[model samples]
Target chain A: MRIILVGSDKLTYFLGRRFTSKGDYLTIITPEEEAAVDLSRRLKATVIAGDGSDPTVLQEAGAYQADVLLALTDRDQDNLIACQIAQDRYGVPQTVAIVNDPDNKAIFEELGVSVAFSATEIIGSMIEQQTASEEIRNLVPVAGSGVTMTEVVLGPNSPAIGRAIKDLDLQGAVVACVVRRGRVLIAKRRSYLHEADRLLVISEDDQYGQAQKVLTGEGA
Target chain B: MVSNLIGGNSSASKYIVVIGCGRLGSLLAGRLSAEGNSVVVIDQKESAFENLSSEFSGFQIVGDASEMATLKKAKLDKADCLLVVTREDNVNLMVAQIGRIFFETPVVLARVFDPAREAIYREFDIDTISPTQLSADSFMQKLNTHQVSTSAPTEGVA
Candidate 1:
């Protein structure tokens, strides 16, 4: 696949290297002439020195044939405009942008960029999730699916302890499996819950709170 | 006329928010406020606000226009119009998109230095002014008028 990566020299170099190794055509656009020369020597990809947000620069970078355009510039506005030009003008099928300001995620998505993410936002949420509750060891929300995977450890006084798997009214959540003393146990109707057993629960995003409350006996 | 385009009733003062606070932003804000319309100018650098004239009577915000918090502080959602005149074309375009798409501000105008980027702004239904293109057109018209009047190159220069 033809790919165009704009800005963030280090990220461009790494991604360019990875994609080129997979036999994908990679083009890197940067504003620094010196960096362009250096990157061209280091990577097996075309390197162009120009403003990423400029339509002429993107045209020169072969954006028309690009299957994907990744705008990883530190400046949120530059990334946004680059992605916009790539998608609207060049007709790139997929456009990904790294939003420097987490608050701009909605703005980027609303503007029609295929994927917009913020490293700070991801890290911030991960930190919050880690410290949010003691019983929930890990929680992950599947992107665009409205499904959540939660790893909850049953406590001694938990209402779910000593109850059979089928008897636990999880409010539409399903118990995928259980982990006891690091041993994976597939959740079955006859399998009984035990204190300290880690349950991997899969549920709709909105039902996770009730599911967790049922298992851990605490409001999430 | 500006008030009418922004949907403000005739004889009523319209709220205008100008981003950048550069020469154009300051001057436009000053003129709008002088016209009895409420105006607010925003700039990343506080020193940029020094460009505003004494006749200007409006709020000044020192903040980045790309951030929603800053725009919220400027009450951009409540503004009748938004003028994005930042020196950076991408910045002007980005802020204009936010105002038009998120805040739904009426009569959003942005200054894009790169003429090639005007298409993106147009596709988003945001109005844009390209100074580079405008100046080039003006220069071309002047050159064409001179050529039509005089055939001799030396005479045209003189």
Candidate 2:
């Protein structure tokens, strides 16, 4: 996959390394020449030293051929601009932006950034998840839809442990996949769950808590 | 044109929503409110709103203008005029576009820093004032007048 990364932050470095290590064609646009030089030395990636928000910089970064454009700039403005320019001018298939302010997530979505995520919100959610009674961790979301993909770890004494996948009163929820003792399997309708089994469910925003409740019902 | 219609006395007081509480947004919100228009000013940082005059009677929302939920919370759908004056030209353009596209606001104005953003605004049929262009024009005007005045004789200007 041809990927264009903008910004020289640690997140940018991490993503660039991941993509480059996979041998996915990666082009990084960093404003600082020193950072670009440092990154290019470490990874087999093309580097464009300039503002990613600039059309010329994006053009030099092979934006037209990029499958995904990640705007990881620390500045919300730059991220917004880079994503917009990428989508508008380059027609990049996917554009993701890292927003500092959580409120800008919705705004960025309105502004047409394919995915806008905030580190603060993610951290807050992780902290909230840690404090919560159930050990339900959010997995990847189902692509463009509002439906969320979540993994629920069934505690030893949970309600649905002994039940079949179809037996759980999921209420419009579907078990996409299941992981048992690190073994992955397709969730058959009659597939049974065991204690410590992880079930990945595709559910809407409002259905998440109910799904959690059904999976992690009354017990320690 | 739309701004003029909204500002005229023939119409009822227009609902104005100003995104960003920077010097320009704060002053504009205060002035618009003082002129009997209903104004709501939004900013992510609460401290930025201290720039507004104490006499300002408009509402204030502490939130990001780019977020649709924040706009809904600010009741921006009812705005007759919207002003986006965020520090970043990109943010201002996005917010202004939201005002134009989502809310169908009668008049949407944006404060843009980069002169290149004027084309984006024009593409969206939104109005924008770029400080760079304004400054350049003002500087050129001043330069021309300065040269003319300096070259002219004291009493009999050529």
Candidate No. with top lDDT: 1
Off by over 4 Å in 1: A127-220, B1-10, B151-158
Q: For model 2, how does the per-residue alpha-carbon lDDT over B61-140 read when each residue is reduced to its tens digit?
A: 99866667889998878878888998878778777877887788888888888776576557667788888999999999
In candidate 2, the residue pairs with backbone N, CA or C atoms under 3 Å apart (3 or more residues apart, or in different chains) clash, namely A107-B66
lDDT of 2 by residue, A100-217 (tens): 8787888788878999999999999998868544568787777778789887888886899889988888875788899887899999989999998888888887777788788888
User: Cα deviation of A136 in candidate 2 (Å)?
Assistant: 12
lDDT (CA) per prediction: 0.88, 0.84
CAPRI band for model 2 = acceptable
TM-score computed on alpha carbons, candidate 1: 0.75
lDDT of 1 by residue, A45-153 (tens): 9999998888899999998899999999899999999998999998999999998888888889998899999989999899876775478855788789989888888
Q: Which window of ten consecutive residues has the lowest lDDT sum in model 1 chain B? A: B1-10
The DockQ of predicted model 2 stands at 0.25
Residue B83 CA displacement from its true place in model 2, Å: 0.5
Candidate 2 TM-score for chain A: 0.62
